[model samples]
Target: MTQQHRTALKELQKLDSRIHEARQRIAEFDPRFEEVEEPALVLEGELNTTRNRLKEMKLEERRLESSTVDRRDRLRRLEERLGSVRNLREEAAVSAELDMVRRSLQNDEQEALGLIDQLGKAEQRLGELEEAHAEALRVLEPRREALIAERADARSELERLEGERSVFAQGMNPDELRIYNAIRGGGRRAAVAELTEDGACGNCFGIVPLQHQNEVRHGQSLIRCEACGVILAAPEPGSAADAAPAEASTAVTEVAVASDDDDGGDEEE
Candidate 1:
């Protein structure tokens, strides 16, 4: 394997990982994505609850009204009986009965009035809830549409990236692909790294010893960083030529092998 081939392999690994991650993310959001009809579902449930409450309140008002009518009919019958009284005892009994009926009618009227007040307040609240519900639906419509459009665009982009990744991966050996996938399984970043001007792994920024750098440059075999366990490659000719002197000068001045243990840390997706 030449250095160029290794670099291409590394780049292909990176692209493949990116494609896989994008696909996973898209899958997660497929069923209940923000772009779907979530807002409509929420609004529908709320509207149904409010309408049910309104229906119950109206039924209660009708029941109260019927009770009031029944009380009025009783009072009318008692008033008629008062006229039939003939003796003092009978008249006193009839008068007492009339008084009781009047008191009962008054209580019924008061209760009816309270019910009317409550019904009015309930109607007003229902209207407010309806208005709020309408406004929420109105606000949610455009947002939902926009999200749907965004998802569509993302899907299209993901498709294109996947195609590109496929093309790149087709050129790589199965063993290379396996290694790349193994690294990606641990985290989002798949490729270990290439060498930088400072003789360090580009991904981990850990120092690459002179021997390791030569191995990576020669491309006799695939190389992985000892510290970070990332595959390493050399930069392109133009960059490598420019980097060679700085690396040589640093190595001469330091007179000590740079530690491979110093890691630059993992790259994020």
Candidate 2:
């Protein structure tokens, strides 16, 4: 591969990493959207439960009303029998029975009144719950749409970056592409490392031999680090230089602009 191809590959790696991160960030927001909607969902569930309870209470009120009617009819029959009593003993027995029936009727009436009051209170509470549910929906509706729009925007940007990355990668040498893919597939963030000022591998911090360092600076051939198996490239321009190597190994001044991982050296002035 030409020096230019290696240069393009380096730029491609950086873009690829950025695209990956952008997509990851967008994916992360899915849960956030769900969280935003949770309050409304919870309120809806509560409202449904309350409405169901109100239905059951209404049914109970109807049952109580029916029972009250039955009791009143029984009281009327007892009174009519009292009027027909012929003897004093029978009359006294009828009076006692009449008193007992009156007490039962009064009890039923009191209970019916209490149920009606409860029904009124329950209806009021139901109205409040319904209003609360509507308000919750109103509050979140716009916020939810905003979040959705934000996600759509992020996705669009991710797609654009991906397209740029694909075109950039296509310009890279096939051999370089295979090597980079292999390193990335192994879960390493950087497929290549730039040598440090002190001639150390940027990824593993392992020292590189003076001879291999020269080879990376020239960008003529791909060189892998013996210690970490990462493709080694020379540091970028403007990086701090260590004491100039003794004359015997001083020829590696030119930088190849080769691919490096996010571990790109902090270039020193």
Highest-scoring model, TM-score: 2
Q: What C-alpha lDDT does candidate 2 achieve relative to the native structure?
A: 0.74
Worst-scoring 10-residue span by lDDT in model 2? 260-269
Per residue, candidate 1 scores C-alpha lDDT tens digits across 1-269 of 24445655766776776777777766766665544556656766766776777688678768767876886787687677777767899878877877886787788678768777776876776677678767777877787677678778778878999888777766655566677768778874646566787788888788988898877766656788888888887665454546566544433222122222232221211
Q: Which 10 successive residues of model 1 have the least lDDT summed?
A: 260-269
Clashing pairs in 2: none
With candidate 2 superimposed using the best TM-score fit, by how many Å does residue 176's alpha carbon deviate from the native?
2.0
Task: Write model 2 residue lDDT over 54-140, tens digit each, in one string.
Answer: 788788878877877886887788789888989999989878888887888788788778878887887888888788888888988
Model 1 lDDT, residue 126, Cα: 68
Clashing pairs in 1: 192-230, 204-264
Residue 169 CA displacement from its true place in model 1, Å: 1.6
